[model samples]
Target: MKVSVWDTYVSREDGKQMHFDILVPSDLKDENTIFNFGKSYLKSKPFATKGLTSKECRFCHVEQASESIEEAIRSKGYYIIEMENCN
Candidate 1:
């Protein structure tokens, strides 16, 4: 199994920006696939929750700004798969 990564930035509620990556399989290359993968990846994270906010925790920014970042990743086509598969 191979993994694809998309690098991007997210803005906190305080307007602080942070960088993170959206990871998926290289086989899932389409925008819809990447978008759906982003949603699933976010929902599966421990930090994800209802009414998530970026008030004090920067990590919460990820949950709040996931859609936009995912769209940006899809639009930019900035994704890569590592040679080695962790799977």
Candidate 2:
């Protein structure tokens, strides 16, 4: 599936930066919904994260999704690819 990749850099409560990608269908353009998806991902993490806003997350690119990512988006409406300081 074609996906929109949102490059996100959020400040962790521990004073470190967290980088990740918020992936959703390219057609999904609602910023609020995307931010909510990002919030949901943060909730799944053990550490607390600063609020996710447009300043912290922006459209990075669009690309073809992998099989796993496609399946994830099919079920959850969005998927996250954690890049740094996730643990």
Model 1 deviation from the true structure expressed as Cα RMSD, one decimal place: 13.0
Which whole-number lDDT from 0 to 100 does residue 58 have in model 2? 99
Q: State TM-scores per candidate.
A: 0.39, 0.96
* Local accuracy of candidate 1 as per-residue lDDT tens digits, 1-87: 344555534343444444545554455556555554444543544443332233311211112334544565566543322222111
lDDT of each structure?
0.41, 0.94
Q: What are the candidates' C-alpha RMSDs?
A: 13.0, 0.7
Model 2: per-residue Cα lDDT over 12-84, one tens digit each: 9999999999999999999999999999999998888888999999999999999999999999999999899
Q: Which residues of candidate 2, in runs, are more than 4 Å off?
A: none
- Each prediction's number of clashing residue pairs: 0, 0
TM-score of 1: 0.39
Best by TM-score: 2
